[model samples]
Target: MISKLNLENILFLDIETVPETENFSDLDNTKQDLWEAKSRYQRKKDFTPDEFYDRAGIWAEFGKIICISVGYFNIEGDIRTFRVTSFYGDEIKILKDFKNLLLFHFSQTKHLLCAHNGKEFDFPYIARRMIIHNIELPYKLNLFGKKPWEVPHLDTLELWKFGDYKTYTSLKLLTNVLGIPSPKDDIDGSEVYNVYYKDNNIDRIITYCEKDTIAVAQIFLRLRGDDLLNDDEIKHI
Candidate 1:
């Protein structure tokens, strides 16, 4: 499938997210009850809602996107460069800018949005957050009546799955097996909340998000049986 697709047409992306608020106490009483109800299945019997609040970012309703970094392959004569860009700061502004990019540049039928485990996490999370912010959904993301195959969203994780339904693959595991450099060298998803709220380090989070986007693009290349990107071929824009 990847061999039939143009790498240049795929906009590879990854996002970093954090809990909507600094702590659980920040939520109102009704929301607190809702969170408790929503999280009870995952939280261990000993773990309270406050203790499990660190994981709120995984759900779009309880958390917000802090960084969304994207990369695309730019092929020149005998050379291929992957250029990366990121949108951070205010969530609504970030979503708006990203939506504009999609609307203006990648709105063509051949263009695709690619991410690892995007079908389950990144794609739906973005759509849900956009609705929450009352922003119009990008054409690629709005799947109101489109057939499954017509969605134009690519999931590297889904491709890797093939037919197996029981197994789950993490991006870190996929990169390790495929010989791509690890993107989680500095911080994994678990630490983003603390890094964003406690340390107040949006730059660090953006850098980490961009690394994951780069890794996603590299993984896609590997899936297409191409060589990993070289250091000189990476340009941060």
Candidate 2:
């Protein structure tokens, strides 16, 4: 039903993230410390709070967003095309450029932005980073004060709920169930931080991002009953 729900007003987005580190020490100063302490307590069976923070700091220092790939369906051609851009320089500048692109392309449209787990992670991350850079968020993104379900958000993960709140699904597993081809290759969620940190290869990041965007798009197509990808539509990185 979502497919017939107006493709003219949808923007598919995905983000790459590294753990928060710029103000890690500042966490010790506020109520956030309690949350951190609780998280540590929960994960105590694995690692201590200090050790976890230390390891996270190491990844934050080296883990950068190398690429952000965005895909949009071409209504005229009935084809989906994507653009994978790199952010190899300053993180601030990169975030700004990305924000600007969103503003330019999506500001005037009544578009429903969709992403996997975007409600929790990608959306807030981008909004906070934009504020840090003194950039105003675009209209569709100004949903901070709105109710989660009221907003024009189509999180595939949420849809998989199928009327059950406790039924959570991972993107990988959902794609498999839907018969969508999984693009997961040598890299995975855990390896993403390491790949970006250790190799510093933008191409690899771009590949990873493109695959994700494509997967999301395919999921949308299936929900809409539209034709999904054939061999020609796929681009392997």
Candidate with best TM-score: 1
Worst 10 residues of 2 by lDDT: 54-63
Q: Compared with the true structure, what per-residue lDDT tens digits does model 2 show for residues 1-237?
A: 674676656667676655444334545456346536645655576965544542342232223344556666544565554433434346677777766767787665466777877776566666666665677877666786877565766787777677787777777887899999886865766666556556666567667777777788788888777777765655442
Off by over 4 Å in 2: 20-39, 50-66, 77-89, 144-150, 234-237
- TM-score of each predicted structure versus truth: 0.98, 0.78
Task: Go through the candidates in order and give each one's C-alpha lDDT.
Answer: 0.93, 0.63
Regions more than 4 Å wrong, model 1: none
lDDT of 1 by residue, 138-215 (tens): 899999999988998998898899988888999999999998899999999999988899999999999999999999
- The alpha-carbon lDDT assigned to residue 234 of candidate 2 equals 52
Clashing pairs for predicted structure model 2, backbone only = 3-224
